[model samples]
Structure formats: C-alpha cells, structure tokens
Target: MVFFMNIRHLPSVFFLWLSISLLSLGGCAQWRPTTQDSVKPASTGDACEPGVINLNRVTGLSQIIPELKKARAVVVGESHTYYHHHLAQLEVIKRLAAENPHLAIGLEMFQQPFQPFLDEYIAGDMDETTLLEKTEYFKRWKYDYRLYAPILRYAREHRIPLIALNIDRDITTRAGEVGIGALNDRDKSHIPAHMDRDVPGYEERIHPIFDQHAGSSKRSFEHFMDVQLLWDEGMAERAAEYLNQHPESAMVILAGAGHVAYRTGIPARLQRRIPGKIVTILSSDGIKLEPGVSDYVMFPAEKQLPKAGMMGIFLEQKDQSVAAVGFSDESSGKQAGIKKGDRFDRINGRKIREIADIRLAMWNRKPGDVVDVTVLRKGKPISVKVTLK
Candidate 1:
C-alpha cells in the first residue's frame, strides 16, 4: 500500500516551489474529469464511537453538519492521492456552503507564490489552464489536477474565494537544510511571528518522517522539525489571516488529512492564533482510522490505498463512459492482453470510467499480484488477467 506520513504524505520534496515555478509551465497533456453523478445517499452503520463514525449513518452525518455550518472555519482533511476523499470533501463543502453563503475555499495545492494567479482564476480574469500554467500546477503539486477540478469548479461557479495556503518551497527546503532561525529577512517576512509547534501529539507522529529526509542533519532534526511545524502553522496562519480579513466568511480549508489529524496539526496551530470556532473533518482511505482528532470523520464506501503498482498503459478518456486503452510499449499492458482501443470497464472489480478510475483501482496494488480486468474491445465485454509490476 502507498503510505502517507504526515510530513512526507503523497511524496514530494518540500520548499522546491521556486525552482519548479521557473520550469516549463505546460499543462498536463491528458487532464480529464468524468461526469459527476447525483449525490448518492450517505451510507450508515452503528457508530456511537468518538473517533470512528460510519458515514452512511444519517444520524452521524446530520449531527456533524450543524456544527460545521455554525463554525467560522472548517477544515476538511483528505488523502491527496485518493479521488474518493476529494469527492467526499466536495459533498461536505457543497452541503455546508448552501447553508452559509459566505464560504471561501482554501487550497493546499497552490502555495503563497501563486495567490495572484488563483485570485485571477477565481475572479474570471483567466482560464483554468492559464491559471494552472502560471501556478506551475504539474511541477509544484504533482498530483493529477483532474481530481481537484470539480471542487475548484464549484468554487469558481459559486464565486467563492480561493485562498492559497502554503509558503514557497524554497523556504521550506532551506529550513529543512539549516533552520528557520537561519532565514534572511526576506524569507523571515513570509513566516508568521509565532508557531507553538511543541504540541504534544505532533512530534511523535512527524519525527520519523522528518528523520528519513534529514540526511546527515539528524542531529539538527529540531531544525527540520521547525520547518515541518512552519509548514503546518504556515497554512494555519494563512487560513487564520484570511478569516481575520473576512470575519463573516466561513472558510473551508482543503488540506491533507495529516495536517488536520488529531486536531494536532494545522487545526491545533490555528486555534492558538485565531479566535473563531474551528472544526476538523477527516476522510479515510482505509488507513487505520484514528478517532477524536476531527469533529467529524468521513469514510468512503470503498477502501483502497494507492500503491506503486503499474499497468504500463496510457488510457484516453472518451467522454463520460470509458477510458480507451491507447499504448502498450512492452510493459505490463502488453502482457495483460490490453490492446489499443479497448474500453476499460473494471480493474480488480473496481469499475472504471476514466483514467482516474484506473489510477484509483491500480495505484495501490502490489507488483506481483495478479488481477482480473474487464474491457470492451469491439462492443463486447472481455476478461483479461494482468500481473501487476
């Protein structure tokens, strides 16, 4: 399974945004989102537990939303690689925004440097692709942008403000190497005045991840820890800053669950600095659900962790129905009996309608595991078996 640590979650180097921004700003070649369905009713089960609540339970969902609607700020936690978590987040935002029209959506994907571009995008002054190009979306965030397109669209359609909530990666990378105390006046200006990082549960959770990336600076892990805390607190600080400017606006923050977990990451940091009522909602993708961290926890109907598995095929999305197979260049796709123009219907039993669906099904499968696939070749369903690699 693809593991997501609080520090290294979803795998990308910190503080490299400035360099990435200088690179080519070309948009992704094949960014496509599938048609969305009507909101299915939430599934529920017996959940009186403090930490874990079955999302399908109407009683649980009902109890959670009122508190969210009443808050000045709400944090919705997500696993970046999981599309379903994004869906759940959109649903929560959709429902809550209806109740409170003064809602602003803050994104973790776009950092502080691209705030102007995001503002332009939200203000209808620029197209989404241009905004993404200006923001270096592909290189900076690295996640498939289509997974986030729907939520962004809803915000744009609703005229909701999109707040960029991260600091530049160059500063993050610099802090990781030395310490925040070593920052020059220019870099220091970007950070907040105070970060109470000594929160009890955070160090125990983030230290090992920081250690792995610390290299020879293991002795200076405290410095690296400062960088990590700065990351969380930086986001929290930005969110709080936005709320300060628009006290009537109820901000819905879109961030990785790691930052929102246990109310010990960004939520903890934000509460110390801001006076508004804050609520944390965590979404799970089959990682052991930790309870009592967020005010409400949402679990998708399906539980799959993204893995480093490979199908070795490129899929082209054809409208809302299916992703047609395109290339098989002597990789796993060739061995899997997947021919060009085959329409994918399912992988390991997970239904496929787009390239993201294929990623959802195959991202976490182990390399050697054999799985069954169903595809429509020439208007007929066919079964093909492929061993993951």
Candidate 2:
C-alpha cells in the first residue's frame, strides 16, 4: 500500500494539493508485457468486441471498467496538442467517475501558481468564465475551449477534486538554462534515485522525439529530461500525500505520454518507493510496458492524432533541405514569388535543411544582405537574391 501524508494550506492549499497530486501520479511502477500479453489475441480485425473483458487490450469503456476497479490510480498518457486525446481522456474520466463515486481526476495543465484559481472555481468562489480566462494556456494550446470545458464542468458538477500536477513553466525554463547537472547537490536533492542513473534504452526512446526539434535553441532534450525528472519526483510525493488524506478515493492522472510509461519514467520511479501499487499505462495504441513492473497494460480502441506543430515540424531526411515559405506580413512569400513546398538548396552558399538555419543567417544583418536563396522551382534550380527584412 502507498502511504500518503496529509498537509493542509490556506487559500494556497490548492497549490499544495495540486503538487501532492502530481507527485503521487508520477510514482507508478515499471513493467513490461510479453507477446502473449499483447492485444492481438483479444482484438478482432482492427477493433475489439464491445462488452468483452479483454485484459490484454482496452478497446472500449467496458474493457476499461474492469481495469479501473483493480487499480487505486490510473495514468492516462496524452499528446498535449492533440484535441482528440484530450477528448478521449475526458470520456474515460467521465466513465470512471460514474463507475466509482469516490474518484479524483488530476490534470497536467494547472501549475502551482494557478491552484488558488482552480480552488476558487471548484469551491464556487468564482464563475466559470473567470476561471477560464485565468487559464489562458488551456485555451491557447489549440484555440479550442471545448477541449477543457468538459473536464472543468465534470469537476465542478461532481465536486471531484481536480488536482493540478504541473510545475511552473518559468521554473522549468530556468532549469533548462542551467543544466540539471549544474544544480548543486542541495538543489538536486529532491530528484528520485531512479532518475540519478541513466536507464538503458531510455536515451534511445527519447532520441527519436528529440531529433525532431534538433535545431531549436529553446528545445533541449537534456533540459526536458531534467524538468521531467523534477516534475515526476514532485508528482510522486504529492500523490502519496493525497492517498494519505483520501484513502477511500481512487485517482487518475492526465499527463503527457512520455511521463507515464512504466520503464525509465515517472511510473518506475514511483514503484521504487511503493511496492505492490498497480501501475497502468493508458494510450490510444497498445500500451508499451517495461517487463514485470506493470500488472496490466491497456490501450484504448481509438485512433491517435499525429504529434506535430506544438513542437514544430519534423523533416524527413530526404526533405531536410525543405523550405516552407509562409508570408512574412503577407508580402515576401506571396508578393515576392515564394511559394509553399519550395526546396531551398542554399542561401548565400550556406546549405540549409531547417527553417532555424535560414533565420539565423538573416538575423542582425543590414537591410541589404544580398542573400541568394536557391529554390527548386518546378524541378529547375533558380537563384533569387532578396534583401534582408
């Protein structure tokens, strides 16, 4: 059994509760599934039959029902930018809440600073519109309010404890600037033991995603790993605290897919501290496990949207030298004869693959840079000299 600590705060209690929830959710045990444990046996064609107890697969609400019964906590992995994933998570939460009266839903969106606002909304101290305006990121992520409206509504109507589990973005940015290793021992003391060591195959799993944002100055895989570890450690501790306070209730954590996986992730770190706590990974596709740690792995019978745009585009190796000509104030790309899908072979003798490189070359230059942009126009290479903006 996982032991949780009870700590109360004033109006600021919301932040404390949110932090506690994050820590608890991050602490799932690591486990892997075998070929025999996969969904292949239970799935028929591309989908599973409704009302069947497919332990190897979670095709519909019926399959998820049984899994929800056994675990004290459920962690749903999501692609943050995908509106569909958010919708699916809300559906699962609604089903779980209905099935079990004493259920709490945790979110990765709300940070410690925004906890008071969340508390006010949940406590009916503020109106829905005010709360929504306060949490603009939730609205701006996809410019769709409907994505988050359901969860907020459910939490308010049901009086369910909506736990906020994300660290402040500013803190994350600062951590990124100063490498995790650069942090003093005292500062790094909060990190979990599992995170101290490099797990085999962990880098391999992360590299593919990291390579996608290879050129961005703000995108650092190491920084991401560091912030993730810190967030997971904080979340695990908080979850234990929440469980301590509400032993009768079951919790569900909604976070990015990368943080919820059983091996070399928040779940594994959590399992290290708490034994016998059943950790499950929920994804749109079949759940990938880390051998012997997770008791059950479940995937929803839903199609997942592609992961792009929020992090930016990932160019294929062949499309490396690609140039996307978006209108710069609706003038250059359109009026100056630049079109979309134009391949930029070179810019003033500097071979370019990504848009970042082109921007860097143009930065801080005089009005007339005399930069020659070589474009592959209709299978014919053409050089056009354009002045810097």
Candidate 3:
C-alpha cells in the first residue's frame, strides 16, 4: 500500500535577491543574530534543559531535539517572500533526509490540478523545460533554480518520492468567495468539525496591509489566509491518509512559514493526528527550538525581515507612474482609475516621483479623502480627483 514518490526540485533565484535586500534593510522586526558560540549541538540521550531558554522570548536551534526525535513527519515553516527562510528550510530538509532515507518531501507550491504534471516530472517522464512551464511560481519568485533542483535531483537519483500537497488555488478562491461556512454539506463533511469553529478575534490580528486594502479586493488578504488555512487542513488530511496507507514511510512538507507556524497551522493539525510527529521552523532570525508541538527550529546566521510589507502603491521609474502592488492597504494608482500604463505626471500640485513623496503629500488624508491626480494618458495630460476608499 506504500506509494513511493520523488521530490520535485524548483528554481531558487527569486528569493536570493529578495532576502538580501530585506536583510540589508533591517526592516524585519524582532530579529537578532545567532553566533556559533551561542548555539551548541544537542547531545544524545540528554533531556532538554528546563529554563535553558525563555519560551516566550527567542530561543536557539538545538533546544527542540527531544521533540524532533519523536516525529514521524517534520514540517518546516517558511516565509515565501523571504529568501533566507526558504534557504534555511531547504538546508534542514537535506540534513533530515540524509539522516533518514525514508523521508519524502512534499510541497504547497504545486496545486491539486498540477498533480499529474508533478507525477510525470518526478517519474522522469517529463523534461526540465516542460516541468518548468508547469510549475511557474518558481519563476515568479526569482529563486535560484539550483537550490531546489538539487533536492529534486536527489529524489530522482535516490528514489525518494516528493508529494504535492495543496488544493487548487481556484477552489480556494471560490471557497473564500462563498465564505467557509457556506460550503456544500458534502464538502463540509470532508472538513474536520474543529476547523469549522470561528476563530475568535481573527480579524483583530490581521496585518495592517489587509486592513488598508479590504475595499480594493473582494476578499482581504487575511481572508485569503483563512481560505489557505482550510486548504492546509485538507492537505494535512490527505497527507495523513497517504501516511496511514504507508505506515513505514515519513513525509517532509515544504510550505510557506505562515502555513507551518506551530500554532493554528498544518504542523499543529498534523501533530494532533500523529502526536509524536516533529515540527521544525526555519527562518532568517535563526532556528527556534519550540518545545511540546515543535521539535526544532533552524535559523540562518543572517537576520532578515520577519514578513514582507503589504501591497500598496509604488512609483514606477518609467513615466513616474504609481502602481499598486504588494499586500498593502490604501487608495492610489489603479484603484483610482489609474491605468497601469498611465504615467503619473503630478499628485496635487507637486510632481510625484516616489511613494514616500506621495505619502508625504497625502499624510493627513482619511478613507473618504479626495486628492487631485494628473496623469499622462497616451501622451495626453488629464486630471482626475480620486476619492480614497
């Protein structure tokens, strides 16, 4: 009944530059560097020292070994936009896989719709070019291909299976549109009862970016996470089903850090199903060793931003156009009928050259505020008064 699958390799260039910039900016919050002297390897047969590190605050990587040893599945959390976090996770998988050959790598990148393509790629039935085309997210992230390519090559060369564990994004989007509570009874039956419970104060914890752009998009980014969480739960259920059928095998799931965070995440759900399973978190802040649910945390030597800022208006150099992007809240550019191709000639009475300048010009504005925008549309100058949402 055991199904063997090989891990798929993805290109890694996209994350490298991004991580470097974030690290340099020092914008990532609550980050501190870990020196070799500060972190020591866990000793065999030694119980984790109590009070060795404060649980509420930051901790080192070696503290969670006891939990790691008991895990049948290890899910490493990562921040998709951060290069350091992704690199750290990849390194953790390599070490864990080397120690345990039965480990199979899984990914949140490939959706359910792409499973057949993934299967073909893993089976060596598809060529690299075709495989690249099928998994296009890799290109968008600009991650270096070599980092993930080696892992895929390792799986193929060593006969390890890589599982694609994700629901199709379209399905996820539909679920969000209808609200998680409105799914068909049959579909609802497939989800765990506990998952249906309304998360208390869920809206309070939403990042600032979501709060700002709630009006621009039908579903806010936080709502997107809610949908993603449900998708993750389904993915966990499927992974468990696969594992139950193959009791002798282990799985390593690669996903964004948010999906793998110990609390309210896939690792939490997986641990609930398989109590002794280990969960690891890898990030640029250095590895964290969480007790109880999480077995180990690995962080790189570098310190980087914990998360990327939300999408908002950015000034484009060509034509000085302000475009909306990232995960941010605020009215500017496109939401105001500012076409992507339009040049922002002026904001108010001043020439707009950068986002900071725009913000400075409109700092006191509220949601119902109005501002004058002069745009060069097709070489014709036009003025429009855009009211903020």
Q: What is the lDDT of residue 336 in candidate 3?
A: 60
Q: What's the lDDT for all of these models?
A: 0.69, 0.54, 0.53
Which is the better candidate, 1 or 3, if ranked by TM-score?
A: 1
Candidate 1 lDDT, 1-389, residue by residue in tens = 01122332322211111111111223322212110111222223422322222222222344457656877778888889787788777877888888888899988898898899888888889987667667867557768676788898888888888999988888888887778988899999999888886787788888767657626355577776887788898998999888888888888898988788766788778787778577776764544443244455565544344455576777677985565555546567667777778888888787777666665555336777887999888879989888777
- The per-candidate count of clashes, in order, stands at 11, 19, 32
In model 1, the Cα lDDT at residue 104 comes to 90
Give the Å error, residue 364, model 3.
46
Q: Give the worst 10-residue stretch by lDDT in candidate 1.
A: 13-22
Could you give candidate 3's per-residue lDDT for residues 1-389 as a string of tens digits? 01111113222211111111112122223222121112333343433322232123333333333334346776776655455665666555665666666777777766555666767877889865466556553422334343355566666666677776776565566677776667677666655555532333233334443657536454556455567567667667666766777777777787766555434467656655663444544442432333222233443544343332221444455434554332234634456666556666776786766544454455435555678888787879878777665
Measured by C-alpha RMSD in angstroms, how accurate is candidate 3?
15.2
Number of the predicted model whose lDDT against the real structure is largest: 1
Candidate 2 stretches with Cα past 4 Å from truth are 1-59, 133-145, 181-196, 215-221, 285-389
Which structure is stronger by TM-score: 2 or 3? Answer: 2
Predicted structure 3: lDDT: 0.53
